[model samples]
Target: MVVIDINKKYPEIWEFLAEVPDPEIPIINLVELGVVRNVEKEGDKVIVTITPTYTGCPAKKLFEDLIREKLIEKGFEDVQIDTTLSPAWNTDWLSEATKAKMMADGISPPTDDNKVVTCPNCKSTNTKIISKFGSTPCQSFHSCNDCLEPFNYFKCHR
Candidate 1:
């Protein structure tokens, strides 16, 4: 439940690293998705802490490499990547703006745990879960009854 105000704490680094997009969802950046956690700069070394959306996430290695490459591309020499699973990444970490972006992209962002799924295409509550797993393990396949469009609902992970 402890969300770090990373933007303010590591303003320079965070702002620059915001360009690294999620491989699966190109519209969203990794930083705002809550995958990238803490950032520390010690001397010439920069440490980036991250938590995967899922423990066995397939993009885990890609995330580390992308972050390292981006840092190096930005003139960083010694970049250290660290993984932390203590607090666990959750959908709640996603900001309202992030959710909005997901919605705009035709992917339904997670809502309250008790609420029914909403169709991103037409904002309809009448939706059916097509599959527990969508294109990615973090999302679930759903079809909207009103729009008749199939979409992915970013699964709630906490």
Candidate 2:
């Protein structure tokens, strides 16, 4: 049997969670995605609260499994992962660092205006949307005249 002190264990838990990446955007970890809302420990059980990026996002199931696996690997046998949709998700939840990372990765970060997306490749404010849908549902495909590079724009959320 493994014993863990909740207060003493959070640092390790945070570090472990940092390893779980957003399945769709592997470049960004789920923690950076702002999906992990809270973590608590009740005796031997570890409770994790997650806010989904979208209501019907396909990655939800995968994220649950990944979280469970990660906790188990970290010596937490009784893990309870609770997903909450109440507050819903907004692109605003993304950290500035995460946004910058996305831009650096050639994936256009979300804009303050849901409709107008910037070009990641050239950092051009002048861009046109090719399609509302990009490689993923959460993103839109766009091309920049300045750089002429096609990139995926993170769709602005409500």
Candidate 3:
């Protein structure tokens, strides 16, 4: 939470990053997706620290490029990106609001215990895991028994 709070310390920088959407999930911005870890301002330079959802995340380079581009587009010439794995990233970083937004978009967000991943299509708890891997590495495929709809569940990572 302390790292997230650093984002608030620089509202403008955070806002700039917020405009940069996730490369895969374009519906959600990087900030809301919990990819952006910290933001700091030093003189004429802006430092942004980000943590990948997972170490092997393929979108790592794209995330940095998008962030740098967005900041530069906002008139920031010196934008430094720092990748940190100190505390690491976890599903707990996602907020309730962000989860709701994901759910509304037909993607089940991760849960605390991950015991139940409701179907976003029908809001049914009667679901079963279809595959350990979904269309993406961070998600798992699932099917809703009631609605008979296939969906992806954002896997719980800690």
Candidate 4:
């Protein structure tokens, strides 16, 4: 295990992690997606705490592998990843900027109040869910009545 000066290496570590894209949603990195919970240095080892977006999210393993690969590539020999299930993830954890980006990318983020789903293409409230499940369990299929465009809505995890 190599001794690392945290003060000097912390920023670089975080920056690299921030650049690791989410497997399912390539557009947003793990940091912006709010899956990365905490980072700490313990005795020459780097420990990263992460929370899965959902209990059985298929991307969990890929996320861990990617994180490990990234840290190893960055010369962190002893890397520890801690998966925390407590205080399970919530859609509210997502940043406003990320939500906006999701909408812009043709995926409508869940409405906080569970109101009518909006169409990302036309910004219309006349949208109906075509299916409760979309490409993934965390998403649902919806179509805009006005624009006749189908889209995915990132379901809100309460």
Best-fitting candidate, measured by lDDT? 1
Which ranges in model 4 have alpha carbons more than 4 Å from their true place? Answer: 1-9
TM-score of each: 0.94, 0.89, 0.94, 0.90
Which has the better lDDT: candidate 1, or candidate 2? 1
How many clashes does each candidate structure show, in the order listed? 0, 0, 0, 0
Candidate 3 structure quality by residue, lDDT tens digits, 8-119: 8888788888899888878789998887878888999999998888888999999999999999999999999999986778777788898998899888999866799899
lDDT of 1 by residue, 19-100 (tens): 9999999889998789988889899999999999998889999999999999899899999999999787888889999999
* Pairwise lDDT winner, candidates 3 and 4: 3
Sort by lDDT, top down from the best: 1, 3, 4, 2
Better of 2 and 4 by lDDT: 4
lDDT tens digits, residue span 1-158, model 2: 11222243477787889899888998899878877877889999999988888777889899999999998988999999998876667787777899999999889888777666778876787888889887776888889988888889998776
Residue 39: error of model 3 in Å? 1.3
For model 1 the local lDDT of residue 21 reads 94
Stretches > 4 Å off in candidate 1: 1-7
- The 0-to-1 C-alpha lDDT of every candidate, in the order given, reads 0.88, 0.82, 0.87, 0.84
For model 1, which pairs clash? none
Higher-ranked by lDDT: 1 or 3: 1
lDDT comparison, 1 vs 4, better candidate: 1
